[model samples]
Target: MDELNLENEHELLNSLETILTSECNLHEYIDDIPQIFATDNLKTMSHKEETNGENIETLFDKFPMSSNVSKDNTNEIVTLKSKCEELHTQIERLTKEKEEAFEEIERLKDQILSQSTYCTSLGAVLGNLTWRASRFPQIVDTWLSNFQSKIGEFLSIVNGTFGAFVDTYRSAFPPTSNVEYQFVMGLLGIVTNISASPEGREFLITNSSGMEFVQKLIKLMPELPLAPGTVSLKRLMLMILYNVSMNKTGLQYLLESRVEDTLSHCLDDEASSEEMQLLCLRVLQSVTYDLDKPKYIHNLIATIPIEKIEIITSAKRSDISNAAKQVIKYLQHSQKITK
Candidate 1:
């Protein structure tokens, strides 16, 4: 019995060694084994071997590589996070700068708009002041002589501002609002009478600035309608033309504009009163006397309508009759020349 027992112990030890060796080659044996150790068999083992040699080999192979890969992945993730943070900061700064630039542009636009409005208002005020100042001739003369610089400054402001006002207001109001129209006429009278003065002649010779003012006023003349019996506007216009005719240079200026053409239109209606006819006749006679200049004569004769001339000659106002007869004499002379 003792001998048999020793043999059995030797066989059992050898079996145990074989099982340990098989477990150690777990990596190689994984495909061959259908099942690892059964739960009941593991519990019956004297020493607890929770993991096989195959499992140990798997742990050794995977642990170092997986740890190194995890470290690399962690570094990549940190770099991406830093880049995202930088981009977010740059976007925020750009957004703020864009907002500030937009606000500044809007502020500048508003300031420009405000300044434009103020300049227009100032221009209107200066125009009205000039109209007021022109009402007194003596004051104008004194201002022109003693304070020539002041006169120039005032005229500069007036010319600039009134030119704009006439352009704007004439479109809004009727052509014959007596108060406003009279003020314009009065200003023209001031310009004409002043140009006739010795100081004005000197100013014109030196500066040529007043000529610009007169040209602007003459351009504005179409806005004033010939309201019947309201002689103030027509009188002022004729006076300006008369002054223009007196000087050879001024005569050339007046004739070049063909103002005579406008005078014909003013006298078209036979219904025009004697006073209106007289004004028209006077303008024609004054313009035609300078017929010695071919340019002036041609424009003057072309401007006088034959029918209106006949009607004006028949209707006699003592003031207009003399002027109309002088116009007839000039026309007869012009016709002879044309023939």
Candidate 2:
């Protein structure tokens, strides 16, 4: 029994020595090892190691880092949302810019087309009229013949290019000579001649820019100096008004324009010649002749100077007296109807 006991103690010491030699290397880092099994109670050491592992797992479960991960995820989502909104705003701005660019392009295209017509076809016609002063009538006649069927189209050209020409000449410096003025006069004369015909009258009445052109002409008339040199200009303009009045539409436009007021002023002006007064009376006669509408006729009667017209009814010139008498008759009829 004693020998057996000695052998058991000797075997235990050898096992302890082997474990100590394997676990402790003094040449290596001490922090590389987590625990030292210093006791000979191996079973107790194993139990303690298991308890420590469980405590570590419990500590991690109590205070987890998942909330920081959640916050980071939320921040990332917010950043992405902001970027998306910025992209959307950029898209909207780009879309609006695209639409505006298209509108500008369309406007530019129309302007280019108008300028092209001004430089080419209509420009060529006006150039000929300006350069060829002697053949003015023939050129006008030939132009009318060639474009009579397309009067509406021709008037469109007049509205665009010829209108520009009139403005240019009217505003030109005196150093440019009287040719420009005469060119404008010639153009107005062409318009007057065009107004003489029924088809031409209708075009002037109904075409989109025709009455607008007439309005412009009337506005220009009052600005012109009605001297001996401008008598023909005034006469041509008055003749256009007279011819336009032959149609009901034309008459309405004239009455609304208060052309009677202008006529009355002309009659009252002492500087106005007998021929001008006669022409004025004739225009008044035309203006009152075709008035089936009582309101327009009434407006004319109310607007014109009745006493002045009555005084002229007994004038020396038969034509002037006759025209005054006709106007008086129309006014009397209108007054009787109103009563």
Candidate 3:
């Protein structure tokens, strides 16, 4: 009996050892095996064995290589977190910069609007100012010099204002509502005084800078319809053309620009005043006298309203009659030559 009890006890110790090794490998076997070790002594022995093995495994987890790996992982996490914070700060700064840039752009736009508005208001007194300026040759000379020096700036404003006027005139836009008309009239008044003199005409059409202004002006001329409402503007434009036409160089420039087409349209518009008709006729007559090219004469004849001009030859106004007669004679001669 004593030998059998010792054998059973030794067998139980071997089973407990096997179970503890399995529990260490699986981690779940410890709880499951405790039920099999129901006796108090066996349970106590199993607990003691599990506690010892757990302590050994905990020491292995704290080995130098594992400790170094944990430290490296903690450092990497901290570095990534700092980079994320830096990126967030930079994003906020860039967003603020973009907003500031947009604000500056809007401010610049407002300033430009204010200047244009001021120019429109200034137009009301431009006629008087130009008249006063014309009396002083020194002022006129200085003005002309300044104008030539800043021709580009001058034209930008003039052309923009004129283009707006053209739109207002062409559409059903309220004529009085826009500053374009008043602004144009004021500038035209100054231009009229400038073009009236031979020196001024040369400065306007012969100078390289002046040619650009003239070309732009010519391009805008055809867009103005010859109606009663627009007649005053048209007349101002015609006067400028006529004054500039006195210069041979200016005339050539005008002819090459096909200004005769615009003149023809004016002559045929019927809404044209007698004075306007006379101006158109005179310009056309000048074209006939200066036309050295067959193509020019042909173009002149093609564009002019011949029958209407012939009727004007017998009109009551002697100036208009004489101008029309000369233009008709040139057209008739050109027609015969073309045939």
Candidate 1: C-alpha RMSD after superposition: 23.7
Models sorted by TM-score, best on top: 3, 2, 1
lDDT for every model?
0.57, 0.62, 0.66
* Residue 212 in model 2: lDDT: 75
Indicate whether candidate 1 or candidate 2 has the larger TM-score: 2
What would the per-residue lDDT of candidate 3 be over residues 2-55, giving only the tens digit for each residue? 334677667646644553454354444334444434443543544554564565
Q: Looking at candidate 2, what is the lDDT of residue 118?
A: 59
Evaluation by lDDT, superior candidate among 1 and 3: 3
Distance from true position, residue 252, model 1, in Å? Answer: 1.3
Q: Is candidate 1 or 2 superior in lDDT?
A: 2
- Count clashes in each candidate, considering only residues at least 3 apart in sequence or on different chains: 1, 0, 0
Better of 2 and 3 by TM-score: 3
Model 2 clashing-pair count:
0
Candidate 3 has its poorest 10 consecutive residues by lDDT at: 60-69
lDDT of 2 by residue, 1-339 (tens): 133367756764564454344233211213322233233343453444345435434433543333323455345434543543454354456556656877999999999988865555554467446435423556545555676556666566555644565555454332222544455555666667677766567668777777877776566655544355456656766787888988878888888887876776667777777888888888888887736667777667677767878999888999989889998887776667766
Top-lDDT candidate index: 3
Question: Candidate 1: what lDDT?
Answer: 0.57
Shift in Å, residue 56, candidate 1: 54
TM-score of each: 0.51, 0.52, 0.58
